[model samples]
Structure formats: structure tokens, C-alpha cells
Target chain A: MRLIAIFFGLIFLLVGFRNNQSIELIFPSSWPEPIYNDDNYPLNEQKVELGRALFFDPQLSSDNTISCASCHSPYNAFTHVDHQLSHGINDRIGTRNSPAIFNLAWQKDLMWDGAIHHVDAQALAPINHPDEMGSSINEIVQKLNKDVRYKKAFKSIYSDDLITGERVLKLLGQFMISLVSCDSKYDRVMSGKDKFDEQEKRGYELFCKNCSECHKEPLFSDYSFRNNGLEPDPQLKDIGRMKITQNRMDSLKFKVPSLRNIEFTFPYMHDGRYKKLTEVIDHYDRKIHFSNTLDPILEKGIHFTTNEKVDLVAFLLTLTDKNFMFAPEHGYPKDFFDQK
Target chain B: MIRSIQILILFFSLGVRAQDSIPVKVMYDRFEIQPGKTILFQDDSIRIDVVKFYLTNVVVGGSELSSGLLFDLEKDQNYLLIPISQIDEIQFTLGVDSLTNSNGISGGILDPIHGMYWSWQSGYINFKLEGIHFENGIAEEFNFHIGGFLNGYNCERRIQLQGSSNVSRLELDLYQMLQTLSTDQLKKIMSPGKRAMDLADILADSFFLR
Candidate 1:
């Protein structure tokens, strides 16, 4: 841990410590430190508020109809439940499902294929995608510069009215990192505030034996890329991590998404193939595609009884943090937007 | 004793200011670089629409002094000021380093608003050259946006040049560089790979101290 801190400190020093202030990350004491350090862009209330406003604003899209929340709504733990693939501006469907947006500080890489290395730069992907917002950071900066509200906010927060792409991206990153979801029933159970019933306890044991290797506890993700034995889609032909790495060994590999709020953040999988927990479990049980790059853990298909699947799903529901989903701060900043 | 201490402080300040800083200048030659300006070569006439690249890790006398600088042929901001006086040996990378590319978003020349950053991926476009080449009355467009940080696909080039006496400028023959690039394999290289690495090597070979 000391070595990691020193490494992060060296990086901060090398970058010349661009920002002077720092924000303290508040998570469970037992949870590991986030890979993302706050030294890059110091998180403050005003910056997060600006980011929240930008997230919900339709002006971010080229046609001024779509926003980040268009796909990632807070009510559904920041993932869209209405569709399998993400629907962007002009009703264009994207290739992959929009992943949920909580506990982002823990994620060293974003996107299903783990293309984006940092949360600060992740928004640029969807914002500039032709199927997504179809807007550039340059375009957004120009529009925001003209807005009186934004000008005032920028002046107050940054000590100047100048709005640059760096400030805009950092603000969005701050808002995302502020979304900490560690207040679920599972957390309460771990804290000894509550106890799981008989079926749920059995499900937890099964999960520890099988799923815990990849989907580690607390964060519920080891965050490594793996091929979880799914047949390649003929149309998408999305060779996943291979596209980034240009290596055949990395074929079909995708980042292991955190299972926190798994009950709400579905349909499951990178393509959102399954709509129910039982269907996902059945896929693990009966359908495991063998390939050279397939994860060794899923080589022998998991065999779970029908009753066991039901109990497993019951335990998975304990991960849903309703408090986080309904948090006023995480939602659209109505007060900021309503001022106009 | 206090007066002697004051004189010692003055001498120390003078010693600190004695080291001279020089501005690194990029001098282009053997080409008219304005948009749509035709440069007729053997059997082909090329019209360059855009040319931009990142110059980073400016080293003088084996010591690195600068981080990164974006250079656009159409823009007037062509020189980078560095804290070095002598021009004995100079070394610089033709693109942003892999470390900086992975370190996330930053301000100024490294900002995404500059249009050099790849929106789909998380790396800066190391070198961008877009143009139309005419061969046998046939005009084909070519875009070479070279960048990739991972191993086996890294396109950043480390270039070393023997500097002239008291001269801190580097001259690159743009026509020679373009001539060296075969038109057959020059169409739409927007991603990092073997082709991008090849182009980076060809471009890096074209730099010399002036």
C-alpha cells in the first residue's frame, strides 16, 4: 500500500501537480483504495454540480436531444433498462450495452472493451461517436461559453469565466467519481447490521466458491479482461479487446464488470443478451463456448440446480442499493437547471 | 557579516541566471505546404490538405527538458522554448510518449479540443497527415493518423540529430519525406499498427539539425 501511494505521488509530481487542492474519497474503511487518484483534478461540490448539470443537459448532443442520462439513468443504477443496446441521438442503436455509472473511482478503465484508460477521458468516446452524441468537446465548449448560467458558474468555481475542454472533462470526471455505492443490504450484512436468510446464505456460499474469483467482494470485480464463453455475434463481429491490443490472444476478452447493483443494472452481459438472472445462470450452466481465449475458470460449465439459481438471484438482489439509485445529489440538478 | 551574506546571495542569483534558454524551431524546406498547393513529383502530383504532429521529450546534451508540443503546418505556433544553451546533441520523440498517453486528459496542447486526440480510443494521434495524390489523372485521398501506445503497436519515434554550432533549429525536407512514402500503401491509416509504425519511421528519418 505504501509503495502504491509512492507511485501515485511520483506520477502527481511528474505531471507537475496541475491542481493544488484535493478531495477525500469516502468509501467503506475495509474497501481497497481506488486506482484513480484525486490529485489530477481535485473534486469539489461546485465542480460536481457543474458535471451533474452537463450530464443531464441535452445541449451536449449534436441535435440537442440526447444526454449521458439518456442511456444511463440514475433510477436504474445509471444503466438503461428499456433497451439491450444503447440508443443514442436520432434513435441510432449503438453496438454495446451502456454500462452503469457508479463506483467509477475503482474503475481504472471504462467501456466494455476497456478502450478508455481513464474516467476523465471516457466521455469523449460517446460524445464524439457518430452513433452516440455526435458532438465534439470543441463544439460543447463553444456552446457552454455562450450560456450565461455556465459563465457565472465557471467564474465562481474556477475563479475565471474561461471554459476549456480540460475543465469540462475534469468536472464530468469529478461527478462520476463522487458516485459511491456501498450502502446496499450486502454491506449492512457484512457490517453485522443485518443477517441473510437461509436461502440467501446458501447462495452467498455458492457465489464465493464460483463467481468470487472474477467478481471479487466489496467492489464485486477484480476488473480483469476475460472471455466468458459467449459465441461471437455475426453482425457486431466486435472482437472485443483484440481490436485494441491487435493480439489474437486478447480476442473475445472484455472487462469483468462489477456485480454491485446487479439486480437493477441489467439486461446482463456486454451485449445485454439475457434479460433475467435465471437466463444468465442458464447460459453459465448449459452454454459455455470453448475457445482458445476463453477464460479457464468457465472452461467446465457451471452446473446449478433450478432451486439454486433462485436462491443465487435472491442473494444478488442484496447488492441493489436503492438509496444510491434514489440519491438526490446523483440525480439531475433540478435546482441548477431550474434557475433559468 | 550581514553585508557579506547579501553579496553571496547576489552572486548565487547571478549564477542561476547564467544558463541560457533556447527556443527549438522547426524549419520546413523543399515544399509549398499551403492547402491545395500541388507538388509535382515523378509521375504524381500531391496536394496536402492538413499536416499536424506532436514533438515531445526535447533533449539537449542527453538531458530531457520539454514535455510535449503540438505542431501544425497551418498554425504559426511552430517553436518550443527550452532551457538549454548549447546545441551539441538534440533528441526528441516524434509523438507523445506512452506514459503521457495513458496518464489521462491534461490542459493546453494536450487537450482534446485540439482535435489531435482519438475520440474512440484513449491515445493522442501521434502524427496526422491528410492529402490527395494524383497519379495518371486519378486523385486518391490518404489520411495517416498514426498513434498507439501498447506494445507491438507503439508508433512514437525517438529521433536523434547532431546539432550545428550555436544553432537550435531543425530542418525537415517535407517533400523528401512525402516522396519516401509510397502512395500505394498511403490510403486511410487512421489507427496504430505496422503501417503506422512504418510511416513514423520514415518521417523520423527526415529530421536534421539546421
Candidate 2:
């Protein structure tokens, strides 16, 4: 009987150690459960730390100059703000603006064109894009395997030093899924921790009347592809979602971006056409180009007074989570690099 | 203690016998109509630089052999191991199924890192056959990437080889597939669409049991 007790105690300790390795995702009660299934890629501290290192490492690129953080910088809410279109290796400019990365746990599809369906598969696009990172996952894996720092990190975390492309992508996914931005003033108000100001309150009401149908609440996005009536750029001639579905109706349609961090994540739209929120409001109010594929809600076009526009912009500001934008954990893993 | 030792010996003997019965090899042959170093297609000398594809759901004797296997002409994994038993017929898919393509990230042959998947699209390129054809002493490149899983665009082909042999050889005749297309029409096809589906059908018909 005593022997059995000792054996059971050892088993319990082993289980406890394994459990402690994994971390749980936390969010407000009002928010829906994340779309990314944690069972497929469980959240563990070691994996997340490794992912953060890879995220900021320029070695993932062919020239070893561009990193995931180059376009998706955390300071700018994980988006490049200096330019309209994203710049890649050899100063090659990509066709579309780099979309902000946040609240990705709820995103079913990624990219402006909704080309990638899964977040786990998303990093491969930029990595292999000739105009982007200009590197292959195979090449990245070979490089990672040679590094003494990575070998030690892999062994300590995965208990094996074998570095494969799948492990690299999955670890990156773990870090990306950990980027949950739900601590905004809007989230605070929803949780009964704070109240919206008068200007912000009016803007919220106006937003519900005009934009909430597509850019929904709490998460600020329904994660659907829609044609927002932007005229096609003659040079790019990008067909947006139609390139994926091959349907004429999906032409000019793009994924609805979250209004969270709208103040910082600009210039706006897939092409970064509008430089200011006022310009976006003006486009929606009167500059909307009529098209067959345009979203029915924006068919008549929104009518916003100058004063109303200010209020709406004020409300959009409340969605910015300062805590998330400056979180130390999401920044560059300085200690990991210093140790290396 | 005596009984347990006897049982262990019995298990060890059974394992050795199982290993001894397992077949050593299953060969795959890549041919171009005629057996030679250079393949003549439509009077043009063609050299196949690469031929990569996936074989999934290999069923033998009503049991699954393995989930999938990637066959690359450049690699040395052309042969496979089969259990030494009656294999009534070998059934396998020429491409990955729709379920596997939609199941997010996968490992091994199904991993996106293999470059089999389209970076912009969500589906894998089921078959990739690249070669250079010398037309008037100038080398012309031809690439055919066949893959599609969506409705009305599914390019997966199911093949059944009917025979029982210690070494089964599957032949991929590139010349036969090229006969379906005119030389002028043969260019590049890297994305999945109508042309990819059409070529996928032609490629599927090019396979035969030898």
C-alpha cells in the first residue's frame, strides 16, 4: 500500500510539472472564445519566449535585415506607419499595406486580401514572398540549426535540439496568439470598470449607426471580406478577395480591419489611401465610389457632420490599449540576445 | 518468474518472425515513353528536372499503410516498405485530401515548409512537374503545378493498382502527359484554376502499374 502511494505521488509531481509549463489565455467574460484552438498548439512559456525571439530576429529573412517586427512593430500597434506600402528586401515595395497584428485569436483569415486562412500558415507568406522576407522556411531552419543559442533554447524548451520548419512556425504561432489586445478603455467601459466620456459616447452611438454592421463591437471587426468602395489603383489593380475566391462579386473586397488602435495604425485601408481619420470619414460620407460589389450598408454612404466626425474619431481613440502597445513581454527579448 | 520469462521469450520470437516476413522494397519508376537518358516529346528533346508529388491514404489489404508519402525525383526515397502479406490491391490518392488541406498547420510531408503549398492560396500544389524542352536548340522551360480542393476545382485523383508482387513498380510517363498539350500552350502554371485542373487530369492518366 505504501509503495503504491509513493508511485502515485511521483506521477502527480510529473503531471504538475507538465501543467506548469503551459500558460492559459485570459480575456474579458463578454468577449467570445478565441477561434484558434489551443489544443492544436498549446500555450507554453518556453515556446512563447522562443517565438518572441524569432519574431524580433532579422535572421528569419534572407538578407538578415528584415524581421517580422519590421512591418509589424509593437510600438505602432504592430504595423508600419512610416510608409503607405510595406518595404521588403532590396527596397522592394510590396503591393499592399502591412495590416496591424492584434486580436489575431479571433481572426479566421489573415492579410488584406484574406489569402491566408490560418494564422499558423500566415508567416510562410511573408517569409517566401520575393518582395517580402525573400527567404524560405527550409533555409531559415538550416540557419537556426547551426546557431548554438537556438540549439540550447530548443533543447531546454522542446527537450530536443532538432529544429524543423513546422516547429519554428508553430512556435511563432504561439507567440502571435498570445498577442491579445483587450485592455482598451472600451474594454474597461464594457467591463464596468470605467465610463465613456460625452464625446466618446456620442461617437460610439454614431459608430453603431454607421459602421458597427461591419466593424462590430468589443473586437471591432466581424472578420468578413467587404468591398468598401475604394476605386482600383491603376498601377496595382489589386482584385483583393476576388484573387482567392475567383468570384466577380468579391472584387474590390478586403478584410474589415479592427478600429482598435485606429489612431496609431495609419494610413488607413488596404492601400493606405487615406492619411487621416478625417479623410477616411470624408471618403465614407461623400467620396464613396458606387459599385455593384459595394457593401449594402455603405450603399447610400454615411452622412457625418464635421462635429460628428470629431466625436467618432474621439471614440475610436478609446479602443487603443496603451498597456498592450507598450507591454515589455511583447517587446524585443533583450535578455535572450544578450545571453547569446 | 519462470512463466514471465517464458512469455518474454515467446514475444521476442514473434517480433523477429514479423520482421522477417515484411517485404524489403516497393519501387517507383519515372519513365518518358522510351527508356533512355533523354526523353523525346513531340519531336523536342525534353529533360525533366523535377517531378514531385504526394501519395496519400495508401490502403493495402483493407488496412491503411500510412497517412502519406512525398515522392521527389531528386530524392532517394523512391521505394517503400510493405508488410509481407497478400496485398489484393494498392489504393492511393494522387494528392492530399480536402480535410488535411484545411486542418491548419501539419508536420512532415504535409508541412507548408516543403514549398508544396501556395504562399498566397490556402491549398497545397498536389503535383509539380518541371522540365526544359529544347525547341530549335533553345531551352524552353515548362512548369505544371496541379492542385485544387475547392468545389468544381478538385484535382485529386484516386489510383488503384491491381496485383500482388514483392516489388511493385509505378511508372510516371511525362511524354504521355505532354501529348495532351500543344508545345505553344505549354508555359507556366503555378496557381490552381481551370488550366491546373485540366493538366491534373492529364497527369493522373499518365500513371500506370508496371
Candidate 3:
């Protein structure tokens, strides 16, 4: 009996030890399991804290003028709102609009064109891009190595003071994965905690009828590449998915961005062509350009009444999670920067 | 007591067997067509600055050997040292397999920090050969980064070499590849496509057992 008790105790202890190794990814029960394999990069508080610090620090950039947070601010749903296109180092404008950086654990590919397959390698694009940070991982590592704060942070987490590109990228990924925004009014309504207003209810009905196929429920995105019939800009003849696949069928098919927090992430689409939700609705309603590889769903233009359009816009506003936007934990680590 | 003694002897024998296996060294030597200071192909004089590629799924004698290794001509440290005996036949892929390319945040040779990985596109640059070739008294740079793991554009090549040795020295002659292409038509190939696939084919053919 004593031996049996000891064996059971040991089993319980082992289970507890395994549970402590991984930090749970806080997400709604309704959502599907995240595509990112947590085993590759197990979540921990120390790593997440280190990642958050790195995200706000401009030292990652060549000129130390731009950080990941420069384009992806906390207040604006982690996306730049002041400009249509993303402004990189030295005031150089990027081709595409900066997408929101929330609920990224669910996403399979990053960027407008689905160029980056993994979230871990996504930071390398902007870091190496001449117009963006204009910096290399080697330069960033050198800078981080010199900093006492970074050295101490890395030592605490990894139990050693060594800082490598893999460590930096993985830690940054941890911070990104922690940016979960599931506390919106829409989420509340789905959870049976709150009820939608009459306007919002009508908007939800219209959204389900017209846009739910692509702008899916729960996540508000199917996350597939589709050419929604926007006329090709002569200046920036940016063929989206075709650039990667080199397939003619994939021409102009950009990743369908999530409509969550659309109220704040203004200047929509890949190129930031539409400034207003009404304009986006207008485009969907009347102005769908026919193409060889255009999405079949968008072939028959979605016709929306002006009143219905107003209701849809009202429904979209419910997606704005104020708690996530203004969360003190997600914001710039003031104590960390202040100490330095 | 007799069973314990037998187990100890078995363990000792296994340890001795493990130590007896020799480490197979895979060496890479880069060379031009002509044996001289300056690398010359046809009329244009060139210089080979760098040559790097990934060797994956290395199988010897119809059995699995080394999983993968990165070989860089510029770096002396980049070489495979496999602990295997009697290499009768060798088969390996020139580029990274599709599985490793899709698998995120791998360590060692496949790490993104190695500079072999394509940041924009989530795939490894299977083969990278960069150098400067002078054309009409003007120095023109040539960079061929071969990679594409997707269907239809998969540039990974399967190479089978017949050899049996503990230490195999593979010779890559850059001159033979340069001879086929004109300086004007093929200056640089950064992204993966038909051009990259064609150049990779040339690179695979350039390898010879020495």
C-alpha cells in the first residue's frame, strides 16, 4: 500500500512538472487549435517578457530609429493608423499596408502575399529589407550583446548570457503569440454573456448572408488568397500570390486579412487603397474587376443597401477589443525602458 | 549474479563496437577551368567568391546515413563528419527537403541565421553561388540563389554517386557551369524559378568525385 501511494505520488509529480514547462496560450474555446506547433517554441513568461522588450526597442534597426512597434503600435490594434502604407527607416514607404498583429497564432502564413510560411522567420523580411529596418541579424546580435539590459534579460531566461539570432527570433515569436485579442463584444455575444444591439444584429445577419464565406465567423477570415476584383494599379503592378508561386492562376490573389478591429486599422487592402469601410463596401457592391483568376465568389458583386451598409459597419465596430488595445501588459514595458 | 555479469559484458562489447566506427569526412574543393591565379571561362575573366549548398537525405548502400549537412566552399568549418563504415554507394539531395523547409525554427545548419534561408519566402536557398565576372572590360556581378520547394517549381535535385571510401573529396568546377551561359543573359538570379532550376541542374553536373 505504501509503495502504491509512492508510485501514484511520483506520477502526479511528473505530470505537474510537465505542465509547468509550457505556458498555456490564452484563447477562446470556440477557436480551432493554432497552426503554430507549440512544441517547437514552448511558451514561457521570461521569454515573452524578453520578446516584448525587443519588440519596442529600436536597437534592432540599423539607424535605431524604427522598431517592430513603430509600424505595429499597441493602441491601433498593433497596426500603423497614421499612414496608408507602412513607413520604414528614413521615411521610406513600403509597398503594402501594415496588417494588424493580433491573434497571429491562428495564422499559417504572414504578410499580404503569404510569402513567409512561418511566423518565426517573418521578422527577417523587414530586418533585411533595405527600405525597412536596413539591418541584419548579425548587427542586431552585436548591439544586443553590448547592452547590459539585454544581457541580463537573456541570462535570466536561458540561464546563460549568450544571445543568438535563433534565440532572438524565437523570443519575438513568443511575444507575438501572446498578443491574443478575444475579449471583443462579438466574442461576448458568441459566448452568451452579452446580447448584440438591434443595429449590430441586423449587421450580423447581412454579414452572414453576404460576407461570411470569406470573412469567416469566430476569426473573421478564411485566410485563403483571393483576387477580389480590384483594378490593378498601373504604378505598383503588384501581382500578389503569383510573385511566390509564379502561377498565372494565382495572380493578384492576396491573403484575405481578418476583419477583426477593422474600425481602427484604416486604409484597407494590401496597398491601402481604401480609406473608409464605406469605400470598401462600395468596391464590393459595384466595382469588381473581372479577371482570369478572380475569385468565383466575387464574380457576382455583393449588392448592399445604404441602410444595410450602415448596419454592417456598426457590427464591425463590435470587433474592436478595447481591453486588448489598451492592455498595460501588451504596451511598451515602461519600467524596463525607464530603468535603462 | 550470473545474469548481471552477462549484461555488463554485453554493454562493454556494444561500447567497443560504437567506438570502432570511423567518422567519414566529406570535403569540398572549388576550382576554375584553368589552373591559374585568375579564373577564366571562355574570354571573360571571373572570380568565385562564395559557393554554398545543402546536402540532405544522404543514404549510403541503400540505407539512411546522414540526415542533412550544409557545405560552404568559403567556410572551412562547413563539412560533414558521419560515423559510418564502408560507404559503397552514396545518394543525396542537393537542396533541403520540403519537410525541413516547412518545419519552422530548426537549429544547426538549417537555422535562419546561417543566411542560406530566404526571409521573404519561407524556404531555404538550396544552392547559392556568387562571384564577379568581367564582361567587355566592365566587372559584372553574378549571383545564383537556387531554391523552390513547392510543387511544379521544386528545384531540389537527387544526386547518386558510385563510390566507396571513408573520406570522399567532391570537386565542384565553377568554370564548366560558367562556360554554358553568356555573361549578358545570366547576370543574377535571386528568386526561385525556371532560371534557378536550370542553374541548379548545371551545378549538380559540376560535381565530380576526386
TM-score of chain A of each: 0.93, 0.95, 0.93
Tell me which residue pairs clash in candidate 3: none
| Per-residue accuracy of model 2 over A192-219 as CA lDDT, tens digit each | 9999999999999999988998899878
Candidate 3 local lDDT, B79-148, one digit each (tens): 4444455556667888887877776566667767688878777788998777777778988777888897
Query: What TM-score, over all chains together, does every model reach?
Result: 0.88, 0.91, 0.87
Question: Can you list each candidate's DockQ?
Answer: 0.46, 0.47, 0.43
Error of 3 at B23 (Å): 13
- Evaluated on chain B only, candidate 3 has a TM-score of 0.77
Q: Which 10 residues in a row give candidate 1 chain A its minimum summed lDDT?
A: A14-23
Off by over 4 Å in 1: A1-22, B1-29, B59-68, B82-88, B165-169, B175-186
i-RMSD per candidate, Å: 7.3, 3.3, 4.9
User: Stretches of candidate 2 above 4 Å error?
Assistant: A1-16, B1-37, B136-138, B164-167, B183-186
Clashing pairs in 2: none
Residue A136 in candidate 3, Cα distance off native in Å = 1.2
Pairs in clash, predicted candidate 1: none
Ten-residue region with minimum lDDT total, candidate 2 chain B: B19-28
* Model 2 local distance difference test score: 0.81
